[model samples]
Target: MQKVEVSDRDWKHLLDLRDKVHVPGSPAGSNSNPCMSLYRPLAERTKPFVLAQVGQSLDGRVATPSGDARNVSGSDGIVHLHRCRALMDAVIVGVGTIISDNPSLSVRKVKGPNPIRVVIDCNGEIPADAKFLNDDGESVILIQADDVDRTINGTQAVKLPRRQSGLDVEDILGALRKLGLNSILVEGGRRTIARFLDAGVVDRLHVAVAPLIIGSGPNGICLPPVHSLSEAQRPKIDVYNIGTDVLFDCDFRHQYQQT
Candidate 1:
């Protein structure tokens, strides 16, 4: 674990955050808790913790129709992302994100250890020359549905049962936990986030809304159809301003889960 020396101003900000944090049994509004986790399925409490993040435009689009989505969030938002990546044991993304963004998924902007990179490539689609496989020291784990055993450029491939939707999330998490990972950050394209959400296994959701709006593009989360507002999800949100972007840090497990 790395130790950071907080400045007085940062310390004051920490003090101010106390009232902004909210948890189920905690005070109505408190941000004092430095760490927050999603409510795990009873069986998954022993599994690795999971958190998902999304950066969308004001109109809820992750990318434009042409599949261009670079720098949707400002530098501050980008830094916030790297910081979050810096704190996790591993960072996960769907194959679609890799094809679209070709993200390095490393903690370059922040001062912390780089985490294990997890890619959900159910099909064997990722090209052999993918940049993620080139990182010499960083650990890369690819979850694929294909039964053929294979390895590419030093990347370890974990085979799991496949569903029409994608690789089995439960099996994926189980494999990750078995690898000794205690926490994971799920950062991705829409389908990936949807899988975790539909599974009801996500513990935390961090949404950073940029100031711009792209009238049409890919939506962030593809949830099931709901008949009325009463059935809609109402998460307990903690708001924060990261430069020009606004963050909606939400804990869905407590608000939506039935005890």
Candidate 2:
């Protein structure tokens, strides 16, 4: 990958935002993360600049077994999520998110253009009357592994390769980038986030830690077991507080591509 220089002004803006949100209990104080040195300018690269967002409990649970996760991050976190969505070219999620939450996936709380809603549905399971497909002008994409003839009214079903784990992340990004989507925000329901992270295609990740702990629930990222701390992936992270929630901006590209 070609090295892209981050503009001084953009860097300053990010630093200002970081300083503005630094609170007593934020994780930005961590001095040991290896990914910090890789932070640089945000530029147009080979693929869309992808950022994954997750709002979970302190213990890292995103939702209960039954898929109920409303109000976990409070009002400020919701608005912040919307703001992130507004800044991206598209927002993606797995079919599980659509079935469980049936989220409209539009920009409501914030003032900005609504992103193209992309759903990774390898099995063609999303219902015809799903709420995500209800919007008329908004772009919605449903990706499947096979060339299934079934279709939803407003959803554009595209065929992509599927792996044992799920849909191929590389192919997904390539297709989206070809469509002129330069930036993508992945809003997830655990499995979808795990696939991207496991594939190592993720550039940035924003994890919002709410102030509560749900002892028994679905985790935010489900990875293979690692025996030691040294075996763990530690991206450079910047922490900020959005009301009662603490947001961790984890930069993965810098950690992985450092010379």
Candidate 3:
């Protein structure tokens, strides 16, 4: 891992570089660009951490009227998405997203060691044919609520019972921590991201805001209502523009203190 304390000027330069390469409505070229170069270094600095990466439309929608993947973001954004996968120690998503999208959740374009694939299946009911169950490049861990038969190939299944309203976020994080993963990336549909945020577990947030607007669809986050309006002020983000996409970089520690 590259070791260097990043200066404020370095952060500003990185943001400028991201803006130049993360062009909206354009296909990312084959060659490495300013965005990748800038992000690669910053990602290195965020070791033993967690980052929440998500994409949403201008109006805060992550899907189409009928839940189709339509115009979420251009190829440039997708390329950046892969960069997140390459940088983190592991990738996490809820079972609902796994069943709906059937994502292989691998780092394809960028050449780097693939992170461990994690599925938050509260009920140990992942379908036998899920791609992560068969992928060879990275190991898969299914976090569930019951003892599942460990006969599945290319996957390690573990059980962690739900606490209160949903799967215990603290337990899931503990398990990831036990696996020697210092950093984790939470890639999600909606409900999963919300759970992480609501549980006060997400350490950072990287929201890629697409230019298009989807009037009605699944929200990018489905957080439970805060006990009161005052309780909702837990996350205060520092925003940066990546071309048309806005990245909301937040540190939950500060938010927790403020709350």
Clashing pairs in 3: 48-182
Runs of candidate 1 exceeding 4 Å displacement: 1-47, 256-259
Relative to the true structure, candidate 1 reaches a TM of 0.81
lDDT (10s digit) by residue, model 3, range 128-206: 8887776666888888776554445667776777576757887888888888776688999688888788777776777
Ranking by lDDT: 1, 2, 3
- How high is the lDDT of residue 32 in model 2? 32
The TM-score values for the models, in the order shown, are: 0.81, 0.79, 0.76
Q: What C-alpha lDDT, on a 0 to 100 scale, does residue 233 get in candidate 1?
A: 74
lDDT of each: 0.73, 0.73, 0.69
Q: Which scores higher on TM-score, 1 or 3?
A: 1
Off by over 4 Å in 2: 1-47, 256-259
Model 1 / residue 195 / CA error / Å: 0.3
